[model samples]
Structures are given as structure tokens and as C-alpha cells.
Target chain A: MTELTRIIELFQLPFMQRALLGGILTGLMGGMLGSFTILRQLSFFSDALGHSALLGISIGLLIGINPSVVLLPFAVCFALGVTYLLERTRLWTDALLNIIYSSSLAIAVIVLSFVGQYKGGLNNLLFGDILAVRELDLVFSGLLLIACTVFIGLTLRTQMLLTLHEPLAIARGVSVSAQRTAFIVLLSLVVGISIKAIGVLLVSAFVVIPACAARLLSRTFTNYVVLSAGLGALSAVAGMLISAAFNLPSGPSIVATQLVIFLTTMALPQLRALGHG
Target chain B: MREIVLSVEQLTVYRETYAAVQDVSFSLESGIDTAIVGPNGAGKSTLVQAILGILPRQSGDVFILGQPLSCRGSLAPAIRQQIAYLPQNFLFDRRIPMTVEELVGLGWDKLGFQLPWKDHRKRRHAIREALVRVDAAHLMHKMISGLSGGETKRVLLAYCLVRPRRLLILDEAPAGLDVRGESEFYQLLYQLKREQGWAILQISHDLDMVRRHCDRVICLNRTLLCQGTPEVALSSDNLSAAYGSEFVRYRHRH
Candidate 1:
């Protein structure tokens, strides 16, 4: 078969199509939420949430249930828990984040150890076997993407800006607490769905690297979101191509592509003046 | 007498076990410019935060335009829509990608009723008008992270002005501005007060500007020390009570 035909054949399989759809949806949500994440200096928090999802997913597998369903509530609970700890506790936020990040990973490893591995078991969530993604995963991710987009687009002007400067937002009559809670829930949802494509270990890279690259190129916050989404989509496509050609793992290849984009943007002099390097 | 726009009755704010502000009572008339002056750590910011519903109130009631301020429910947003606040510290991450125009446009985001004029052009026009009012129109397209301290303060003030809120509360709004910038800012404040009939409550350390610009002053040192015209409130006893003997002497020297 020719290259195009082979590529078509790869996607013609139900699993490959599911993986592609999942990646695209995750990219859109990541790009949308990632702008606020980077602006609020919560990149570490995103990573923490991603790792926390692993523990949730592993626990789901241990109970013989669908991992995604189990993982959503677990991730949201963890996200709210972290938010409360950061707001109420005396500990510095970064220190608290690091503790949660490592502990979640450790818990996942312990849980996975108890659940004896079958062939391509945890690897599906780690490296992401694009050839094995189910149709249900595709449908769920699409719905999530649409919901996130509508909510974000509706409150884009007020709520997103609130994360940038909360006190100001409060002063202007924006529901500071409500906006924050909604944002955290949305972030949790994004983290929960993204684990299937980028995996728990590398999901943060997908959210952060594209936004960081776009930050260097854009002048306004609106432009930054658009550029980040564009970059993220571009990286997903490129990574898929590279993975197909070299038979590399899809998740790592995607992350590697994003890093390359980040580095290139960092080196550009025009972007350096914008202080994104 | 004009109607009271803001009334604080037995207002108290506590930080953990310690009482930061205690039984502070004041009634600010509509269209009046009131200055809040006190030494650092005297709880000026705490009082402001309490009034804005950001801090938990230990006791007492805050009424804005005859409505009791509720910390929860839609009342908070309703009260907030009528008031604009400028925080003591205005810090943004240098990595954030936003321009002056976008920042100012955020002021209209809280108009939650979905007015017919939600179009981008209308929003842009409102932002541009606000910037021009503060003499920051030229910097509309400038990146926020690149602006100087004085410029940033101006932009923030512009942000506050974009919405036609009845009460404008500013905490050290001109703290870091140079003499000219400070003078120009207060001039703009005077214009806003006279032309738009805005009621302004500001916390300021600059005694001269307080004396020259504000109609009344409220001195605080954990409790209400004095409230009246600048000369009356800045009396030696009140100054000493709020700022200690060192500030009293410093004021006399100047």
C-alpha cells in the first residue's frame, strides 16, 4: 500500500480513530484551560492533577470498572483538595504541590503493583496505544470538549481574567469563589480525559508546552489562547506522523514535538522581547 | 445632607485570634471624596477588604446604598456592580500575555445581565474611552508586563473606571507614582468626582494630596481615630494616635 493508503488504513481501524479524536479534543481543552494555567502560574498544579489521575485510574482498574468514569470524580476531589490546602494551609503552595505530586505517583505505583499486569495493561494509559482506543472514549472526549468550549467561551472575558487577578475581579463584582470553583472543576475534567492520550506522566507537557510557546508569539491573552490551540493541534498531527513513520510511542512523540516547538519559539528574538523565553 | 452611599456599623475584622479592625463606624455621603489614612499595619487594608466582602467579618453590618452587604448569594455581585476597588498591590506575572485594552475590558465582564451592547466593538469603545479619561489612551495596545510602575497604576485606574460603578474604593492608588504622575492622577480623580459625580474612598499616605484633594479624611489605628475634613482629622492627637509620635513630628517638619 502507498503511504497515504497506509495512513488511511491506520485511521480506518476503530481504535486509531478513537485515539486521534481523543488527542484533538484534549488539545482543544488543554489549550483553552492552559492559557489560564500559565497566566496564573499554576503549571505545577496541572502536573499535580495529571499525576493524581493515575492513582484514580489505577484504583478503577483494581475494582474492575471503567477507568475514565472512576477517574473523573477522583481527580475532581483531588483538585478541590489541593485548592483548599493551598488556600487554607500555611504551607507554601509549591511545597504542597510537590508533596501531592509525588505521593499520587507513588500511590499509583503501589496500586498497579497489587493489580498484576496483563499484556499492554498500564501501558495503554502510560505510553498510549493509539491502535487500541475504544469508540466510547472518543464519544466521551468529544462531548467534554464541546462542554468545555461553550463554558469557557461564554465566560471568557470575565472568568478567565479573574484567574489573572482575583482581587481585582472580586472588586468588579465577579463571583470570585464561583468562578474559581468552576475553573478548577473544568481543569479537573480536562486532566481526567487527557490521561487516555498523553498518559498521567506526560499530560502536563501537552497542556503547558503549547501555551508557553504561544505566549512567546502572541500580544494579547485572546491571541495566546488561539495560538496555543493551533500549536497544540499542529503538534498532535506531527507527533502522529512521526509515531507512524518511526513506530515510536505516540504520547512521548507528541510531547517531544511540543518541546521542539517551545524551544524554537524561545530562540526567536521577537518572542524574547515579549519575555516568554 | 446627601444620602449615605456607604454605612459601616460596628464593623470588625479579625485575623485569626487577633482583632485587626474593631467597631469602625462611618457613613459616607453620596458624591463625597473620603480619604482613609493610617500607619502601616493599622488595618486600613483589612477594613477595605472586609467592606468589599473579601475578608470574613467578625461582627457588624455593612450597608451599601441602603442594602445590607451579603457575603454570599447574588447580593455580593449586586453590591460589587455598584463599587470599584483598587487593591494596594497590583502585581501580574510578567509571563502573562495581555494588553492594556484587554485588561480594561475585564471591567465590563461583571455586567452579568447580558446587555444588548455585548458586541466586541462596543466593548473596545468603552475600553478606549476609559483609557482616554485616564490619559492612558496611547498605551492601549502596550503589553501590561512592559509598562512602568506609574503606567501600570494608570492602566489599573482606567480598568476601574471602565464600569460606571457608584463607589470607587482605592488602596494607595498613587503610591508609587512620581510627583507629576501623582498630580495628574489626582487631577483626573477630581474631574471624575466633579463630572461623573463618583463617590470615592481612597487610602492614601500622602498627607499633602489628602489635604488638597479629598473632601474628608477617616483616620484609623485599629479603631476610628477621627473623621472629618483633612484639617480636623489630621489633628496632632489623631495623627499621633494613628501613626505614632514619629509621624506627628514628620508631618510638622513638612
Candidate 2:
């Protein structure tokens, strides 16, 4: 068969289409939320939340439930708890993040060990099988993307700028607490949904590296969002194409493509200025 | 006489167990430009924070346009809309991707209101006008992270002026500016006061600037030392009390 015919046949299966749609939606949301994630210096928080998803996924597998549903509430609670503890306590935010990150990974590994008989299910989650995506996952991811897009677009001016310079925003009457809560919740939702496409291990990179690369290449804030989304979408599509062609894992390929983009952008003379290089 | 826009009676601000601002009482009349002058560590910032409801007031009554200040609820959106504040220091992540225009637009974003009006032309005009007023129109498209200290101050000043608030509170607004920039900034404030009748409360350490520009002066040294026109309130004794021995040296130099 010709290359075009092979690709067409690959997508003719319902699962491939679902995975592609889900990846695109997740990438778009990741790009948008990544802008604020970088702006607010909450990259560590994203990492912590991503790792915490494993615990939720483990529980889902143990109970024989839809992993996404279990993971969403778990991620939201983890995000909110981290935010509250950081704000209300005297402990340094970075230290708290490290604790959450390491502990969650340990718990997930221990729980997964107990359920060793479900190795196949755990492996599916770890290295997301995009070709195995269900229709429900596609619908949920699509709605999430739409909701997150509208929310981010509506509050784009206030939320992004406030995250950049909070005191200045506060002086101009932006409610810092309210805006922060909304942003963290939005991020958690994005992380929860994207876990299936990028897997919990690589999802935070999907949210961070693309935005960081976009920031280097773009001059303005709006451009950053658009460019980040474009880069993320490109990486997801390219990764899926390469993975299908080589019969390799899609999740790692997508993440690897993102890293390549990040490195390439970093090496460009004009973009290099963005990193203090 | 213009009405009192702000009244503080028996105001005291404590940082932990120590009293930072003690028994400070002052009233700012509308259309008047008042300067809060004191040495560093003399609680000028603490006093302003207390009035803005950012810092807790240990014991005091703060009335904004005849209404008691409330911190429990979000500052009344209307009141907040009508008030502008310029903080002393503003820092943002350098990697943050944003422009001066986007930052200034944040001034118009209030709670419970979806900004349905996306009139880019009108918003840009307003942003331009604010930038031009602060002599920062050229920097409107510049990345906030790339601007110099003085340029950043001017941009932030433009951000504050995007909306015409009844009262403008500037904490060290001219701290990092050059002599010409500082002069032009104060001149802009004076012109705004003349044309718009906006009340200005400047927290500054530049006594000379305060003498030249302020309609009234409030000297603080953990308490209200004096309040009135600069000539009457800035007497040598009051200055001495506020700055200890520095007043004598300042007088000699002047």
C-alpha cells in the first residue's frame, strides 16, 4: 500500500481518530495553561500534580473504574491542597512541592506493586496507548478543551497579567486570590485530561517546554499563546506520525518531539536571548 | 473647600508585636495633593498599606469617602474602580510573555464583569493616552521585562492612569527616575490635579519635592507629627522629631 493509503487506514480505525482528537485538544489546552504556568513560576506545581495523578490512576485500576474520573478529583484536591498549604503556611513553596512530588511517586509505585497482576493496565496508563482510546475519552477531552479555552480567553487579560505582576495587578484592583484559585483549578483540569495522551510522567513537559520555547520566539504575550499552541500541536501531530510509522510508543515520541523543538528553539540566535544566554 | 476623600483617626499599624505606625490621624481633602514624608523605616509604607487595607490596622478608623474600610469583602468594585495605587516595587518573572499594553489593560478588569466590549481601537487609544501622559508612549509595545527601571515606573504609572480614578495613591512613584523624569512625573501629576481635580497622596522621602509639589504635608515618625500646607507643617521642630539629627544637616544644606 502507498503511504497515504496506509495513513488513511490507520485513522479509519475509531481509536486512532479518538487519540488524534484528544491529543490536539490536550495540546491546545496545555499551550494556553502553560503560558500562565511559566508566568506564575508554578512549573514545579505542574510536576507535582502530574506525579500525583499516578496515585489516582492506581486507585482507578484497583477499583475497576474509569481512570479519568478518579484522576480528576484527585488532581483537583492535590492542586487545591498544595495551593492552600503554600499560602497559609510558613514553609517554602519549593520545599512543599518537592515533598509532594517525591511522596506521590513513592505512593503510586507502592500501590502499583500491590496490584502487579494488573501490569497490562498499569503499563497502558504509563505509556498511553493512543490507538486504544475510547470514544468517551475523546468527548470528555473535547469538552474540557472548549471550557478551558473559553475560560482562559475571557480572563486572558486579567489572569495572565496578574500572574506576571501580582502587586501591580492588586494595585489596579485585580482580586489576586480569586484569580489564582481559578488558574490553579484550570491547570489541574488540563493535567487530569491530558494524562491519557501524554501520560502522567511526560504531561508536565507538554505544559511547560512548549510555552518556554514559544516565549523565546515570540515578542508579545498574545503571540506567546498562539505560538505555544502551534508548537504543541505540531509536536503532537509529528510525534503521532512518527510513532505510527515506526510502530513505536506515541507518548514518549510526543514528549521527545517537544524536547527537540525546545532545544532547536534554544539554539536559534534570536530566541537564545530569551534564556539569558 | 473640597470634601474629605480619606480620613484616618487614631490609626496604628503593627508588624507582628511591634507598632510600625502609631496613632496617625490625617484627612485628605478632594482636589488636594498630599505628601507623606518620613525617613526610611519610619512607617510611611506601613501607613499607606493600612489605608489601602493590605496591612492590618491594630486600632484605627479608616474612612474612604465617608465609608468605613472593609477587608472581609473584596474592596467595593466601584470604590476600587475609582482609586489608583502605585506600589513602590514591582517585580515580574522575566520569562513571562506580556507587553505594556496588555499590562495596562488589566486595570480595567474588575470582578463579576465579563469584558464583553473588545473595542481594541478604544482600548488602544486609552492605553496610548495613558502612556503619552506619562511620557511612555514609545515603550507601549516593549516587553515589560526589557524596560529600564525608570521606564518600568513610567509604564506602571501609565497602567495606573488608564482609568480616571478620583484618588491616586503613589508610593515612591519617582524613586528610580532621573531628575528630569521625576520632575516631569510630578508635573504630570500636577496637571492631572488641575484639569481633572483628582486627589493625590504621594508617599515620598524627597522632602524638597514634597515642599515644591504638595498642597499638604503629613510628616510621620510612628505618629502624626503635623499636617497642613508644607510651610506650616514642615517646621524644623517637626522635621527634627521625624528624622532625629538629619533635619539640622538638611536645613544647613538647603
Candidate 3:
């Protein structure tokens, strides 16, 4: 009946705990990798992978396999395929990405027609259900967080070298092509795993939003990465709590919180400039 | 024997079945600034790229530090690290989120190895030194995308110089610079070349600058036309030979 009692009741539920933990982990991972996603303009690629996960799911259902398990490798392959196309073809980039993700979604729909539709099985993945978060899902997200953090830490300098100037990086003896492949695989894994919690529609927002927000405030590279991850975690926890309080869906709630953060952080500097003037 | 930093022998590269570069060969001696001068589409950059093992050589071989370039396997990185390069028309994303300091740090820590506290500090010190040498110390905190054309060139030069190098390959390293910035870039390059005894190999269209600065010049028009001292290479006769009727002395700035 009371607000405090209602809040206590929410925390008392095990599923709520799992959702909170999973959301926080996924958010942090997304934020960390999102820095590179934004810088490398791989947001579109991540989005495509997100959609491609649905195609994987459709194929899994058709073959009587678990969709969640199939999503990872399928997404990785899909990203690699895109990378290969980019390297080999002179097609305009916008047309290239548009063709890839759209074809993926279209294939998914056709497969869904034969294997049955989004009634129950597909609905869960499309928009996500935070209330259905399980202990294993939490563990998977936690592992992804650790994996992303370690990869970013280890490859930070090398990836930056490759990204800043590939020819120069090559001259400096960096295997930029190899490094690029590794980065794409990691991005695919993140996008694949993220689909269960944030869904295809909102997965990229978790990535791009926190990084865009952090970009406004960070003055250095290390600070930018740290801040993005921190913002992501905060947005996750805060958004989860807000969603619980208001009985709203968790994914969009979290994205709204991040958008607000980006706007506020972006405006603060201009506001300070106004004060100075 | 005089120290040979790089030797390219009969290198040919094809782009879409047409020879972008054909039977190009030249050797760079240590402490000498060598310029490869040519007209547009002459494949000067292509030659430099092939030498660094960035592009496949259709034929012939490149020996850097007296070892042949394999362009693959474990040896490539080590060999590449020995040669510092600045690419002409470096494909830069204008919205790339990085500062001059961080980007330069990328060049300093090329292998992406996380160092201990002392080594990390030393790396930072080396980065600062490179920036200072290139006269870009003041622009260290600026966002890379926000820099002016000349400043970007200086920062890129600093980035290339962050690590130890035996051979320095520059592809139009001074493209966007003004008169003063261009001269300053050359001065900084020559000062370091003299101090470190580096083999300076560069691609340029500026015959006047090449004549003033380079010890040796290789004139190219899709292939080696002449390789000699700049006086001999950039003479009216030699320029006409490489550039054909397109070559005009008045076109070159003093």
C-alpha cells in the first residue's frame, strides 16, 4: 500500500534482483565498447548485428536449436561478412549497410513465416522482458562486461593507432588488419549478447547514448572511457529503479535516462560559457 | 661500406590491371634526405607504400636495414617499427574523438603494451619530446579534429617520430602547410635527421623545396626516370623528361 513497502516488495523479488544486476552489467559493457563504436562509426554495424541476431534466432528455431546460443556466432559471422564486403567493394557505405541490415530483417521475417511468428517466442527477443531475467543471464552479462573491459584495456593503444591512421600504424609494425578483425568480432559478440536484455531496437542506444554523454564531459581518452562506463552503470541502476517505481518497461526507461544525461551534460558547458560572458 | 637504410629493386605494382608503378628501384643512404618527385598519378606514394610493405609488390624486392621485406608473418611488425611513416592524405574521420596528446601517445605505444609506472611515464615523456620537436607542444590538448591543416601535419609528424626509427618515409608530409609552416616542418625534419642519422625518404611534387632541402632526388613518372643529386634530378631537362610537356618551371614555387 505504501511507497516504501512497494519498493521493499520489488527488491524482495529474485527476478527483480537478476534484472537489476543484468541491466547494470550490460549497460557498463555497452558504454565501454560504445566509445569505440561512436569513434569508429560502427554504431550502424552494431545495429545491423542486432537485427542479424533475429535472423540467427529464426534459423535456430527452424533447426530446433536455442536462439540465444546461435545469436553469438551468427552475429560475429555477419559482422565479418560486412567487413569483407567493405574491404572488397567500392559500393557507397550507406547503401552497403542499408542493404545488409534490411536483408537480414527481411530474411528473419520469411523464416518466421515458415517456423511460426512473434506470438510468444519472438516477442520476448524483439522488445525484451527484463522481468524474465534469470541467474544465468546475469552471469553471461557479467562475463561480457569483464571480457569487454579487458579487451578495451589491452588493445586501447593499438586500436587507437590503427584507428587514427592505418598506414602509419602499419609503418609502426601494427597488424592493423588483424586488429580490425578482432575489434569487429568483439563488437559482434557484444551486440549479440545485448539483444536478450535491451532487444534489437534499443541495444545500440545503450552503447551510443552513454558514450555520447561522456564525450561531452571527458577531457582525456582514459577519462572518456572510464566516464562512459560509469555513466552506463549509473543509467542502468537509476533507470531500473525508475522503471520499478513507475511500472514502465525497463529498456526505454534506461534509454530515456541516458538521453537526459547527454542533454544535461552537453548543456552544462554552454551554460557555464554563458555565465562567463 | 656506406650505411644503406633502404633498397628497392625493380618494384612494380598494378592497380586494376594497369601498372600504377613499374620497375621502380632506388636506394636510400643513412643521414641523407631523399625526395621522390613526380607529376600527378606518378605513383610516388605507391612506391613508398610498396617499400614499407603496405602494398604488395608485383615484382622485385625491398630490403630495409639490409633485410628483405616479407610483408607478412612475425617479422613484419618489427621491420615496420624500424621505419617511421607519414602517409599522404591520411584518411581521417573529421569527427574522430581524440586529442592530439592521446593520438600521439598511440604512436609512442605502438604495440599497445601496457607499461609499468616508470615506463608509462617515460613513454609520456617521449611523446612530449616529439611534440616539442615538431613545434606542436602548444596544440597537445586540442582535439585532433579541431586543429588547422598545418597543425594537423605537425601533430602527425610528432606521432611518427614518437618511436625510434632508422628510416623515415614521408608521403607529402607537408601538404597542408603554409609557407612558414612548410619550412618549419622541413627544418624540424632535417634537424632530427642530422641528429639521429635517419634515412629521410619522402614523396613531393615541390621541385623547388626538393632542390633546396634534399641531398638526392628520384624523379618518377610511373617508373624511375632519373636518380641523382637534386641538382641533376630537378634540372629543366630532367623535369621535362619525367613530367613531359606538363612540366613547367614557372609552375613550381620558389
Candidate 4:
């Protein structure tokens, strides 16, 4: 079969429908929140949260509960814990984040080792299997996407002001700490939902790569946000199609697509200059 | 009687364990422009930040327009709406993609949960009016990251002027400007203060500008050393005391 034929045939299946819908929703959330993540210098935080979420999944599997449900609370705790430590103590921020990132990932590996019944499950968690996207996962991710959209839409102006300059935001009577906590919480939620389809290792690429591309191409803040979101969705869908065609892993495929888009954006301005020359 | 716009009593602000500002007491009345004149590391910026409730006070009370401001939490929205602040060389990411219009639009006093559809025209007009006053009308659509230092300062000044305010606080706001730019900025500030009847409190190192423009000056070096008319408070003894014994007043010859 041709690559396009394979992609179209795959989408005709129920599982592919679920995977595509989940990927698109996850992509939209990641893109929207990624703008704030990159601007606030929390790109690493998303990666850390992704790694930490593996512990929650391990715990969930051990306890015979849904990993997706457990990931919500687990991600929230990790995000809040980091926020609290950063605020209360004067530790170097990157050091603190790295400490948490390395330790949690190590602990998650140990915990996953304890789950001996599910052979070869580690590979699935490390590299996602979008074909395994369940109806429950879709529903959970859909609800999360809606919540994220409404929250971001309503608070975009206030969030933009705060993200631009926090002290100025504080002076303007924005509850900076409160807003920060809320933003990090929402970011964690997005990361948690995405981990199932994008996997722990590759999830943050969905958040950061699209935003990096959008930042290079966009002239205005609004344009940057919109473009980031659009690029994320585009990457997710196109990556899924490419994965179907080549029988490749979905997470890496999506990330590879995003990298191509980012490189294109980077070269566009230089290409334009060359054209003018 | 002129209303007291800002009142700070026994305000002590600590940076880590050491007090950056200790026992700073002051008040600003309507229509009076006050300058907080101090040398480097004199806690002048800390005093303003503490008063604005952006920093935690060690032990103190701040009252703005008779409303008590807590030292721990954020300022009340109502009180914040009545005041304009230009932070000291405000730190932020220079590569942000925000426009001057978006930055100034957020400065409107009535920004809350209200829909943007209502009073959209009014918000646009206010932003443009403030930008025009700052002589940055042409930069309304320009990216904030792309602006020069002087242009950024002007844009931020327009942010302060985007709404009606009874009190204005500036923290070394003209630090990066040239002499001509600084002079023009102070001229604009003077006109705005008079026309709006604003109670102004500014932290400045420019003794000449403070001496010429300020109605009162507060000399500070971690604490309030002296305060009075610039002629009295800026005396040789006060300057020596606040700025240390090595201080020498330089007078420029025209």
C-alpha cells in the first residue's frame, strides 16, 4: 500500500480514531500552555513533571487503579512541591529542579521494576503506544483540553501581563503567587494527560518545540500563541499519519515532525534575507 | 486640608536577614512632589517597593488613601487602581513578543473579570492617548522586545499614564536616559503632576533635578537621615551623613 493509503486505512479503524482525537487534544493543550512554559522559563519543569509522572503510573499499576486518574494528583503534587521549595528556600532554581528531576526518575525506575507482572510494559511507558489509547483516556484528555482552553482564554490578558513582567503584574494588583500556582497546576495537568500518548521521554517536546517554532515566526504575542497552538496540532496529526505509514512509534514521530517545523521557522527569516540579497 | 495620599510608618524591610530599610516613616500629600534622595544601596528602592506591598515588611504599616495595606499579601485592587508605579529598571525577558499596545492596555484601572467587548474603544483611546503623551504614538504596534532603552522607558511611562491615578511612584525611572531626555521626562512629569493633582514619590540620585523640581526631599541611607525642603534636607551635613563622609556635592557650571 502507498503511504497515503496506509494512513487513510489506519484512520478508518476505531483505535486510530481514538489515537488521532487524543493526539489532537493533547497537542492543542500542550501548544497553548507551552507558550507560558517557555516564556516563564519552565520548559524544564514540564520535562521534570513528565519523568515524575512515571512514579504515579507505577503506583497506579501496582494498586490496580487507572494510571491516568492517578497522574492528575501526582503531577499536581510534584508541581506544587517544586513551587513551594523554590518560593520558601533560596536554592539555585536549576539545581533544585534537576535534583527533583533525577531523583524522581530514579525512584520511578525502581518502582516500575517492582511491577513484575506486566512484562515489556516499560517500553510502552518510555515510548508511547498511541494505538493503545482507550476511550477513558480520550474522555479524560477531552475534559482537560476544555478546561485548559477556557482557563487560558479567560485569563490570557492577565497572564500575558504577568508573564511579561511579574513585579509589574504584582504592582498592578495581580495575585502573582496565586496565579503562578494555578498556572503550574494547569501545566501539570496538560503534561499528565499527554504522557500516555507522547510517553514520558518525548512529552515535553510537544510543549517546547512548537512554542520555539512559533516564537521564531510570530511578530506579536497573540500571533505567537496562536501559531504555537496551530503548529502543535499540525505536528500531532501529521506525525500520527507518518507513524501509520512507516510503522513507527507515535511519540518520536510527533517530536521529529515538530523539529522539522522548528527548523523551517528558523531558516525562514534567513532565507528571506538571502532572497532580498 | 490636602488629603494624605500615602503614609508609611516604622517601615522596616529586610533583604534576607539584614534590614535594607529600617524605621522609614514618611507621608505624601496631594499636589506635592517628594523625592527620596539616597546614595547607592541606601534602601531607597526597597522603601518604595515595601510601601507598594511588593516586598514583605519586617515591621511596619502602610496606608494609601486611608486604606491599610498589609505587609504580607498583595495590595487591594481598589487601592492599586488609584496609584501608578514605574519600577526601577524593571527586570523581565527582553525577547517577549508583546506589543506596546498590549502592555499599556493591561494598565487600564478597570481591568478585571469584565468582558473586553465593553469599553473597547475607551481602552484603545486611553492607550493611544498615553502613548501620544509619552511621544511614543508611533510605537503602539511595535514589539516591546524591539524597543530601545529610552523607548522602553517611554512605553512603561505610557503604561503608568493609561489610566487616571491620584498617586505616582517612580523608582530611578530615568536611570538610562540622557541629560536632555531626563530633562524632558521631568518636564512631562511636572506637567502631569500639576494637571492631575497627583502626589508624587520618586527615588532619585540626581541631586540637581531633586533640588530644582522636588517640593520635598528625604535623604536616606538604610534609614531616614533627613527630610525637608531640598535646601534644608540636602545640606552638606545631611549629604555627608546619608552618603557617608566621602560624599562631595558637585555643582555644574552653565
Position B45, candidate 2: lDDT: 89
Ranking by lDDT: 4, 3, 1, 2
Question: How much is B3 displaced in model 4, in angstroms?
Answer: 1.7
Q: What lDDT, from 0 to 1, does candidate 2 have?
A: 0.80
Candidate 1: what lDDT?
Answer: 0.81
lDDT by residue for model 2 (A99-208), tens: 88788888888887877777556666666666666788778878888887778777777776577766656655567788888889889988987887677778898799
Q: In model 2, what are the clashing residue pairs, if there are any?
A: none
| Whole-model Cα lDDT of every candidate shown, in order | 0.81, 0.80, 0.82, 0.86
Residue A147's lDDT within candidate 2 is 82
Q: What is the fnat of candidate 4?
A: 0.51
Supply candidate 3's per-residue lDDT for A270. Answer: 91
Residues B1-254 of candidate 4 have per-residue lDDT tens digits of 99999998998999988999999898999899999988899998888888877888889899999888876745678888989889888667887888889889988835455554457899999999999988899999998888887888888878887888889999988888898878877888888777778899999988888999999999999989989999999888888898765665443222
- Measured with C-alpha atoms, the lDDT of residue A171 in candidate 2 is 55
Q: Write the per-residue lDDT of candidate 3 for residues A1-277, one digit (tens) a residue.
A: 6976897799789988888888888888888888888887777778777876788988988898877788888988888899999989999766798898899899998998998665556667887777777788777778877777777787777776666667766766667778888888887887888788888888888889999898888767778878998999899888988898898898889988999889999899899999999
- Candidate 4: residue B100 Cα off by (Å): 1.3
lDDT of 1 by residue, A179-205 (tens): 778888888888877787677878888
Q: Encode model 1's per-residue lDDT on B65-117: one tens digit a residue.
A: 88887754134566677788888878767777889988888876664534323
**How much lDDT does candidate 3 score?**
0.82
RMSD of each: 3.0, 3.2, 2.4, 2.1
lDDT (tens digit, per residue) of candidate 2 on B24-119: 888888998999988888899889877887776888788877777765324666777777788886766776767888777766555343653577
Record all residue pairs in model 3 with backbone atoms less than 3 Å apart, i.e. clashing: none
The residue ranges of model 4 lying beyond 4 angstroms of the native Cα positions read A1-6, B109-111, B114-118, B249-254
Once all C-alphas are superposed, what RMSD does model 2 give against the true structure? Answer: 3.2
TM-score of 4: 0.95
If both were scored by lDDT, which would come out higher, candidate 1 or candidate 3?
A: 3
